[model samples]
Target chain A: MLTGWGRTSPTAATLCAVHDEADVVDAVGAATPERGILARGLGRSYGDSAQDAGGIVLDMTTMSGFTRDGSTLRAQAGASLDDVLRAIVPEGYFVPVTPGTRFVTVGGATAADIHGKNHHVEGSFGAHVRRMRVVTGTGEVVECAPGSDAFAATVGGMGLTGVITEAQVDLLPIATSRMRVDTERHADLDALMAAMTQGDHQYRYSVAWVDSLSPAGRGVLTRGDHASLADLPAGTDDPLAYDPRPRLGAPPWMPSGALNRASTRAFNEAWFRRAPRERRGEITSIPAFFHPLDGVRHWNRVYGPRGFLQYQFVVPDDASALVGLALQRLREAGAPSFLTVLKRFGPGHDAPLSFPMQGWTLAADIPARIPALRDVLDALDGEVIAAGGRHYLAKDSRMSAQTLSAGYPQLARWRAMRDALDPRGVFASDQARRLGLTLGSAP
Target chain B: MINAVGQAQSVLVLGGGSEIAGAILRALPAARLQRVVLAGRRSSVMEERAAELRGRGIADVETVDFDARDTASHGAIIDAAFDAGDIDIVLLAFGVLGDQEALESDPAAAVDLVTANYVGAVSVGLHVARRLRQQGHGRLVVLSSVAGDRARRANYIYGSSKAGLDAFAQGLGDALAGSGASVLVVRPGFVRTTMTQGMSEAPFATDADAVAAIVVAALAKGRETVYAPAVLRPVMAAIKALPRGVFRRLPG
Candidate 1:
């Protein structure tokens, strides 16, 4: 919920609908844009990452526009990750680093400059963005390349400079959607990180699902990458083109129906044990491997009416000591995340405004009510910043702007470029205003 | 033919409550759509529209206050949006369709109508133009109407107001030609909505949903001028090019 331009409402803004990028763009252009606008995705971000409270917001998902040239893929701002995979994987290419799900738009990916499990090895999605076609505050549609300062600024700028209409994204060659995954149970947080660090180079993507319920440091470490054709059984056809449509239906958001102590525990136990012991071979479609959770759409609604908050934070490796501390806080507060992801992060990009850095990033989707969730997150945000790390603008829905300032050290520099490019500040979101992430206060 | 795959885009309708614009947001697929913020005078109304979007998976929905007549804060409004992130499209969809009878009954109401529809829009439009021109790219979709084609005694005030807006948008569109930015003028017939409660339906009168479909098409094509009824483009031409004295004698 958004009150006045930057004001917040007690109720949360829920994603109850799907939109086309073209329509969203038209709607924004629908008006004369007397005040300008910003694009939002998922509403998963807490502050204003996706909201320009008082102004117009270019809902790009309507663009649902897509095309492919050689290995390069392009899509309208509104195209979601699921949309992208559905279109290309059958043709043998895969999106770089899809987050836990495939419901996000490409524009949101670029604006927030999101990163995923493979961040330590592949960097942020911005790294793979070859060129972006943007609609500025003034209504000019300009093209920005990776080398362009504007692109660098806008990529991680979180839609502060202009709206990204479409982009020429570099795609990767994929043999199949199936991933040859390896799962190992870790005793605590340290073992998980050690496992991730050692296993990162061995795969294109790696992730760990932490058992936030276990005492301080316990969790499950999962690692995988697209298995090369050589790793698959000798087939007579192009295995990459193997279209894996859903055989059985996944449950919808059942309002606390799918997630609970018994169900979550069972699912986690099954997930950890069922992973094939023989990492030697597996065959599946792109959707099954890269975006398994995507099979169940509107999963957020599963958190029930109370809603959910995704508190994602990154801290330097030295901050590992804080892992047990964090777990203690979450447990003491009796806050358990329904879904938690842990990954080892590498040094952040020189974009002057990127989110990932040389550290570890953990993201958790917890019910809105954990008594100490807010305070715990605040403390984590503090520790992460003290360790020279930052939080992801995409998944965050809670961290204070001050913590954000401390986390993203380049906030000031990025804001300068944002102001220089858009001095009028025509593109502000609810998160930015709440965190006071304006030009003056940036890093 | 408009290549839509992988092309992520965002569109923010300032007055998302506008039936014409809201219809447009509805036509787009929810997956590709990013955020739809409906900024208007009524928070409840805006919230309702945002809820409609969320129902469609366009979850990044928001609502904020924006008085079309509020001139002093236009820059802050624009700056606020810019700071949120980058903006690709800005739709200045705020206006008043005041009743002609009411305007005549209270002359002050007439002033409010003009200020909200024409004067206020112009002030905000100028701010939008300058900012978009500076950013170097974007599109401004302005809602002009078939009434803007030619003013008649039936609704001269609202018609003339639209006429002024039509002219402004055309000029703005021209000014941004090579700047990678453009303007789209929407001219639709008497739409069947709350705005036309008392008036008899006109030829080819469409619902908000239909109007939105045409607008989406126009935006994708980046068309300079869009006639809502589609047939209105040609029909309005003959009406506007009509001899004024003769035209006035037969109407109303």
Candidate 2:
């Protein structure tokens, strides 16, 4: 399997097309006598974290079954976030802490312990998870819940914990389908951070979009929160049930040249300007707010013939300066990203490789062909490490194994848990090997 | 951006189901080859080849739709493979051997042969070359032939096609200088494969396995050019060193 987007081109490979859950279980059963079994979700992960380079890859996203318990939802590993959101949101409950897209699976979310715009208020999804079912390397099926070592080990464990066949996620109680968002514009970087810190507290949910293409020292920040039921105006009351007008996709295999620097820069300007200037109290749906980007099926194709590399880094609150510094370096290096998002992270949960903490996380997507791109990112990795921060494993495509080890100090403990559960090293992945997240060689 | 440093990597065989490509992949270090991809016209064959590679310790095997004659999509095809993961190397071994009599009878068929053997490869080579340049490192191993050194009426159609390929590969190697990437040109005379099922063989002709060994060795050294059977090198040198009249009279 080639890299997702963010690179200039695709790589080739020989692969197994596992169509269903039985394929996953069988693949797990056939692994070489060692290691734990971590299931693979969609290949959206930039790095090899989701890929089993030389091991059995249990592609369980194909599993089809779902049972809802009031606000608590239980779906198979193959069930996608979009599937859950669509199935449950209309019933008056919403999944907590969705990432940028909804194509990700429930199993993937637990494995990566994904977080989102509401992270500052709700923490990560791992925190809301009630329980998980995993298949061990020895072919034993086990169950775990929050506070259990297995629970902590499984969530954000990057699939190293076990193959999450099904997960119980705590959904939020919703008043309506639309979110009454109040987006405020920030003239500068400091103003943006100021808006995020103060405004996030007032709203149950929050997110911001920055003009990453802005001059090194200047940028725009758009902040928002969930709309209150009272915010609805003269329109009919049931905005939740109102299906959004869908847009058609590009015909077929569109060229990468469509998403050039000029177009992206222009889009950024319009998005920053038209962010409902002054929080006009517009009624927006859940998909628009949570998974605004999910509309474009293979949006990565926009990057063109050159795929892109996504770099997401979190710097502990102590090193806020590094955020601005890193952007400046990008400008100076002429390596600007097409999209950059900034979010506030609450206290991190238990996953060793999970990417969250009480700090600011900024994510950017850049085409892979840019000269010196790797060097610039490598240097940035050092800065984040110096600040006691680390990179997000899900969005990482090029981090070295050494960097992974150095960034995640608790890796040994995680490894110990993984080994205890899967001594022979049954569960393995290309991402784990590439970044040294798995048990390496013999040791 | 991929740091292949200590991790096992992947290799792509452009010609799916090519006996030669399969042979080469089998001989490479199993630990280093995490995955293998066979790109060709029929996915069925690509699948068969992928299985073969996977059996040789390449647990990750894949097949992509690729048509040599359809050169328009070469860039996307090669780039797509690299994007899947880090394609450590790309082995371009897709080619055809048309009958000299058919080529002599029909110029149209000869042109198709020319496009398949040279034009299609040139397009893919250039497209893959740009990617290799961008990734900062990769390998491009193309299969050429001794016939390319000097064209003869005996097989001018195939000889000229190789002539074009050989030149292109050499130039690509030079273009990649200092880019941390290079092209390895393989000039193997005759290999008993589907392409030459009924060919007449001369002395020093080797099989796919023998060609695989020489090509792999040549690659490990980052050599500019190589000849199968080792003796072919000296033999070709002496041939090129011969008088023009004598060279043309010799069997191609």
Candidate 3:
């Protein structure tokens, strides 16, 4: 059985770990029309985008390899960002863009075109990609660059165009693995948005964690930049040091309802109160500043047996009111979200289906068993669609096809490119099927 | 493959014209379903049903000749359906609720009911199970009935055949446990299909649509066994626990 991290909807599939492009080609060739194929990397995608039941799921993790020359890095699609970081951090290099979690494979990041806290400054992960080798549906390997249609489609096409094997990406040079950080607390939604909009450009990375359960929308805003050697304390040893490991984890058998409204609200209050009203130049480790959640293993399992939903939607910068209205709606419905993150996006990548745009993206985790969950999300979908905003496909388990099309206006162009590359409809997944992405002619 | 939101990509219904199975097919999220194959004795009538599904937005529909009594050809028919592509689900919806009085009076008729409902079901069920196990993932929905709970004099022949089928399905489910294939045995009491149209309403008689709803829900939950109208579960449990003499005295 293959289930996304959300664990809400599980389906069965024939999972095979492919070691190279030849293995991928053979696997794709062996699949019958009904048993389509999909490429999975690290399984970090929060929804069914990585699962293809009753079909062939090529686990790309086995194809992992990493090589570097100067500042350019060539990593296999299956190599996790963490793997690349460990290899290059000591050499004064880091990935140009890193998501909240470093566990994502290079291929998965390319497929989702993931953005991070520094999206306003560095753009999405795909922006730094120089070239990629993809195994098309026809069992042919093609090297594509930024201007190629296959490159654009496969970048955020969710592996529909083909299987990404490896990519050549530009790396960022850094003096140290530590981050110079600043922290602040906001009492309400208005204050938080005002601070972010007016001053976010001054920092390389900025993100805010909001307490949705609080009517006042109290939150903690954190901003950081890679520390320079001069910024580090004197007599520092191994300033470029990088170690990634989990300090704690939830047991495998946690009971359901552990993240109910009361518990979540309490956790949120404590987290918000702990943040200093104003603090600057705090030297924090790279992981501590970018991926605090990664310190805990299986943190998602904390939501419990029934699993949870991570709803992330983005609207244009001008329509920021919708963000406040959304918080109000969730609060009014008494919907409890365990975690809420707000980030500013600078621009989108060339991939037609790339999620980020020049806007504010809010992501929250709501328990699946909430009584008003479906209805509240459906209403929010309507509002998001009306505001010309779209939900992220990587984090979605349930979004109507209508809403999907409404949000991604470039879908038709993407589909045309996908059809040209995969006319036999060989590359498929549950998400593609759910949103009619494989239909090729859905209105 | 069934999509995350519960839409099956392909379905093969053994008794293509079975009203209950048709209802379940309609209840599926049709937009994501690419193909559906209906196998039944009368290909013409099955073709009509296929057309109805196409009208209902199920993109592709195919009908194959399948006669439950022709056990020799069952393997070929099932293999051909699977050869077409991976089948997400196979509904074993074909069976007969023959006239009890006629079945009892005629030895040949009694043998036919036993063969069609018992021997034929086991033969095709095993064939479908083999294909499902090979594919590594699929669902088999077997329509058993409450008549199998305790044999009744009014329909002993039919009840006995169903009893054998129910046991076969349960055992098949166990066999496919680690193979990623599963079986759902649906025990609906006197579902009002064309087969039971003229019969007097059994105590808790229900229609095909209701049974279809239960089957759909069970498929989603990956349930091993289910009783339609649910109340029949306890009712049948009590009936099975009664003394032989007490069970023999109960009315139809």
Candidate 4:
């Protein structure tokens, strides 16, 4: 049984670990229309994007390696950002873009077209990729680069076009593996949005943690940039030394309601109160500043057996008020959200299915078992779509096909291009089947 | 594909005319369901049922002729349903509810009822299980009556047949444990349907929709077995624990 990060809607798939390009070709070649094939990375997508029921799932993590030539790194698609960072950080380089977690593989990152806190300044991960080698549904290897139709479809195509085997990515140079951070607390959603809209341009990275349970949507905003050697203490040793290890592992089991309203509300309250009202230029480790939750292994388990759903949507700057309205709806529905994040996105790239746009994006984690959560989200989906926004497919586990079509107007063009590349409809995932991304019969 | 939210896209009903199965199909989200396959003996009722599902907004609706007593044809019937596509749910809703007095007086009629309920279910159940196992994921919902819990004197012939079916379904569920395919045995109390139209209302009698709602909820929770009108669970326990002499003395 395989499920995505959300641990929901698990389905059985014949897992085939591909060690090289040949194995990927063999796997794709063996796929039939009845049970199609899908390429799986580290399975970081929160929904069913990585799984295919009664089909072949090519596990691409076994083929992993990378080589750097100056600022450009030619890396295997299966190489994770975590592994990439470990190898390149000491050499004064970092991935151009990373999502909330570093466990995602290059192939998964490109397929999802993930964006990071630096999105307002830099585009999504696809923008940083110079070129890629993909094994199409017909078992043919093709090289695609920027401005190519293949590249546009392959990136954020949700692996429907083909299996990405390798990518040439432009790396970001870093002086040290530390971040120069600035922190501030906002009393309400308006303040946070104003501060982000006005001052986000000055920082390389920015994100806000909002208290969904709070009536005012209180939040803590953090912004940072790579720390130069002069910014670090003179006595610091091995400034580029980078090693991130999980400090704690969640217990084997947690009760279904362990993260209920009472517990999460208190946790959110304490977390909000702990942040400084305003603190500037505090030196911090890259892992600490970027992925604090990564320090806790299997942190998602804390949500319990029913798992959780991450509802993330991007609305244009003109419709940013929907963010506050969503929070208010969640609060009114009595749904307890453990984590809520707000970010600003720069202009989206050429990838038709890519999620990012010049807009305001908000993501929240709510327990899947909550009775009121589905209706609340459905209502939010209508408003979000009406506001000219779309949901992040990487984080979605339950959005409908109508919502997908309404959110992504380019779906028809993407489908046409995808069908051209794979006429047999060999590449399929549960998410693809659920959202009608492919023309094949629903599985 | 059944999504994380428990919305199934495809369903195959083994008994097209079964009221309980129709209720369950209607209770599901019609807009999300892409296909509905009703397998039963050919008749206008089957076509009308298909038309009804299509009218409800289900895009694809098809029917195949299926005879419960034709054990030799069971494999083909199951293959026909699966060959169309991967079925997310299979409703095993075919059975005979013979009149107790007439069945008891005529041994041949009693044997026929047993053949239809027990023997026929075994044939189709095994065939469906094989397909589900090969597919690696699907739910087979077996509609077992609460009478199967114990064979009372009033309707022992029909009750015993259902008892055999319930046991077969339970064992089948165990066999599919780690195969990612499993069975859900739904034991509903006296449900007011065409089959039970003329009978006097049994205590705690429920409607087909109520049983359907319970089954849907149980399937969502991944339950192996459930009693419709859930109160029947405790009530059945008391009935099963009664002394044999007292149980036989109780009115039908």
Candidate 5:
């Protein structure tokens, strides 16, 4: 049995820990006809994309190691972004793209085609892949580079086409591990959106944490760029130091309803108040600047046994107002979303099922213990779909098949390619089955 | 799988026709429970239940034969269930609440009740616990009763059997403390199920749905033990403190 990061929608599968390409192929070959298979990274997908109920799940975390060559790096499917960063940061290099956390594996980033705060400038993780090795449904190992059918299908393919064995990625050059950050507080969503739209181009990374509990959609906005050697104070000897450790961990057990509306609102208010009205060029470590939440282990447990859901969606730039509308709906519904993350996406890649596009994306984490959590999210999904926005598949756990189909118009094409690669549907997952990605339509 | 909101995608009810288990599954948010497996000795009844769930839009509904008396095959049955896919909850609801008078007269009947309710539950509970531990997560729901809280003269045999089951379940839960798996012991006083249809309604008697509601809520809270009709907690407390002579004077 396996579950995604959201800790919801658990499914049972025959978990096989694969140490290398050979093990993955053997596990794939051993899959029964009645049950399909899927590969799992660090189980950070937030949903069921990496799990196949009653099927086979290749635990690829053990199949990890990496080799770097100047600006290019080759890594196993399970090599985490954190692992690569630790190996390369001291050498004055960084991964081309990283999501909110560095705990995600290289293969997962490739499969999800993940994007980071710098997406407005650097594009998604897929854009930096030089080539990759994949174990196909037929148990054949093949190397695919960008522009190839296999490459396109495997990228953002959600692990349906084959088991990603390894990949070569292009790295970004950086002079220091520190990020020169700028922070500002906004009283309304409109002001924050305007600020980001007009000035975000000046920085490499930009994101806003909206106060969803507030009626005005108030927020704290931050923009950052990789610090150069000159940006560091004279006393700083190692600007490239990259050490990340959890400061604390939520206890395993907690009473349900621990994070109610009152507590969440108080937290949001305090967090917003702590941020400076305007600060610039403040040097912060890489983890502090980009993956602050990563410093706390098992933080999801704070939501109690019900855990929490990450509802993320992206709409075209013109429909940016939908973000505020969605936030207002959550506020009106008293959903008590603990956090609201807002980001801008540049042009999306060619992966048919890739989540992002040239748009505005907002992600909210709502504790599932809320009685109306599901209803509120369903309502938000309708509003998002109506606004021509789509939910991020990587973060979705409860969206209906129809909503998924409506969001990703190219799903049919992606399914066609998946079918062509695995005619027997040997590579499938709960998410795939739920959305009917391999079954033609919603089941 | 258990979801972020205490919703499970799949459930396996060992006692497929158990109204309490059925109600528990039904009370859960329909969108969260996509699959259900009703495993019991009665295939036709399980199939009927599965059909009803299927009609309600549950994606997958299956039936498997599970006889509590078949203790030797418990491991295989558990393995088959997990093989079917990750079962989020294993509901141990099978038990024979034999007639106290009949069991008093027939030693064989008394032994049968003990075997099915206590010995059999222990065997299967251990099997399910092993599988859940191997999976590194899941829930084992044992249907105990307030009778287990004390062996009463009205139903001492049944009460004793449940008492044994309850103790064993709690111990198993403790053994699994850090394994990401846990056990839930549900003690419903007098549930109005088909099993207890002809019995007089006891004080604070509740229906299967009511007990099911409490069980769902308790599971969400990650509770180790719960007494249905909640009022029973205070009532049971007072009863447990009564003198032996006074307790014996209570009617069946």
Candidate 6:
């Protein structure tokens, strides 16, 4: 049985770990239409996007290997960002974009087109890729560059276009691993939005943690940029040293209702109260600023066996009000969400299926056991569609096919390109079937 | 495939006219169901069941002829259903509950009942298992009865037939262990359906909808065996352990 990070919708697949490009070619060659094939990385995708039911799941983790050439890092698809960071950070380089966690593989990051806190200043992960080697469904290895249609289709195509074996990505040169941070607490959604809009350009990275359960939608805004060596304390030794490991591990099992309304409310309240009202120029490690959640291993288990759904949607800048409306609706519906993050995306890339747009995106984690969750999310889907927004396919497990078509207008075009790349339709996944991504003719 | 919330997109009911099978289909999340195939003997009852599913928002409702007594045709009937689409759930609910006293004297009727209830099931069960294994993922729900737990004097003929079926299903489940296909043997007590309408209510008697609810929950949890109303598991155990002499003396 295989499941995404959400641990929901588990399906059985024939797992074949491919250690090289030849193994990938052989695996793709053996795929049958009755039960197609899909590529799986670190399994960090929150939903079924990484899983194929009754099909061949090519586990690419074993193929992890990379080489550094100046500021360009060429990594195999299976090499995780954690591995990339450890290798590059000490050498004064960092990934151009990273999501909330460093456990994501290079292929997953590119396929999902993950965005980071710096999305307002930088673009998604796909924008940094110079070239990639992909094994098409026909068992042919093709190298695609940025301007090629295959490159656009392969990036954020959810691995449907083909199996990406390796990628050459441009890296960000950094002076030190430490980050110069600024923090502030906003009274309500309006204040938070206003503050972010007015001052986000000054920092390379920006993000806000919202209290969805709070009526005012109060939140904490944090912004930072890579600190220079001179900014470190006078006696600091090995300023570029980077070592990140899980400081703690979540319990193996937790009761289903452990994150109920009352407990989450109290936790959110305490979390809000603990933040300093206004702080600036605070020194923090790279892990502390970007991937704090990674400090605890298997933290998703905190929601217990029922698991949780991370609903993330991005509306155009003009439809920013939908972000506040979503939070208010969840609160009114009595849906308890523990972690809610709000970020601003600069501009989307050429990838048709890429999720990021020049807009505001909010992500909230809601327990699946909540009775009102389905209705609330469905209603939110309607509102998001009306506001010209789309949910992130990487984090989606329950959205409908109609919603996906309405949100991504280029879906038809992407399908056409994908069909040309894999006419036999060997690349398939549970999400592809759920959202009708690999169904029907392109037109 | 079953979705994250445990809703199946398509279901195939071998015994389409069986009230328990209809109830199970109705009990599923209607909004999530795209297709429902009813395979049973051609009759207005099967058509009515198909109409009911269409009314419940299932866009595709198909009915195909299936004859339990004609074991030779089981493979063709099952193949047609699977060929239509990937069936997420297949319900094997066909069986005969014959009158024991009448069957004892009528040799032909006894043989017919055994062939329909046991022999026909084995044939259809194996066919469905093979397809499910080839497809790599699907759940086959076999509706056995509490009578199968042990043979009693009152309905030993029917009980003995179900006993054979129950064992066959259990063995089939073991064979498909790692094949991504599974068998859910549901041992329901007397259910208030057309088949048992006029009969006296047995201990732990349940309605078809109640049996359906139990079966649906068991499917979600991926359990190998389930007893409708749940209490029948312990009751059947005690009844099986009862001394044969004492059991024969108990009031029917």
TM-scores of the candidates are 0.59, 0.67, 0.85, 0.95, 0.83, 0.94
The number of the candidate with the highest TM-score is 4
Residue-by-residue lDDT tens digits, candidate 2, A272-338: 7776446556667777877666676667766654566777888888788888888777766666565
Worst 10 residues of 3 chain A by lDDT: A434-443
Tens-place lDDT digits, model 5, residues B104-200? 9999999999999999999999889878866556889999999999899989999999999999999999998766678999999998888898989
Give the chain B TM-score achieved by candidate 1.
0.91
Candidate 4, residue A92: how far the Cα is off, in Å: 1.1
Docking class of 3: acceptable
Model 3 agreement with the true structure over A99-210: per-residue lDDT tens digits: 9899999999999898999899889989999999998877889899999999999888899999999999999999999999999999998899899998999999999999
Query: What does candidate 6's lDDT look like per residue over A1-443, in tens digits?
Result: 78888877767788999999999999999887777999999998888899887789999999899999999999999999999999999999999998999999999999998999999998999999999999998999999999888999999999999999999999999999999999999999999999999999999999999998988899999999999998999999998899998999999998988888999999899989988999999999999999999999999998888777799999998998999999998888777887999998898998999999998999998877665566678889999999999999999988888889999999988988899889888998988877778887332
Task: Supply the TM-score for candidate 4.
Answer: 0.95
Which candidate has the highest DockQ of all?
4
Query: In terms of docking quality, how is candidate 6 classified?
Result: acceptable
Q: Which scores better on DockQ, 3 or 6? A: 6
What lDDT tens digits, residue by residue, belong to model 4 across residues A116-144?
99999999999999999999878999999
TM-score of chain B taken alone, candidate 6: 0.97
Worst 10 residues of 3 chain B by lDDT: B1-10
| DockQ for all candidate structures vs. native | 0.01, 0.05, 0.24, 0.55, 0.18, 0.42
lDDT of 1 by residue, A1-443 (tens): 32211111221222222254344345444333333466765444433366443355554555667888879988877678777787787788888767666777788888777887788888888889988887665546678897777888888777777777788899988876567767677766777777777777787667777777777466766667787777676773766564534444434434533455566657656665665433433445556656666566455556554455666677788776655666666656666564777787766766766777777777766665333455566667777677766777765555555677777777777777776666555666545554556637323
Fnat of each prediction, in sequence: 0.00, 0.04, 0.25, 0.45, 0.18, 0.33
**After superposition, which runs of candidate 5 have C-alpha atoms over 4 Å from their true positions?**
A1-3, A6-19, A30-38, A47-63, A175-178, A227-263, A280-285, A304-306, A332-338, A419-443, B10-22, B34-140, B160-183, B193-199, B231-246
For model 6, name the residue pairs that clash. none
Q: For residue A103, give model 6's deviation from the true position in Å.
A: 0.9
Question: What is candidate 1's fraction of native contacts?
Answer: 0.00
- Docking tier of model 1: it is incorrect
Residue A129 of model 2 has an lDDT of 85
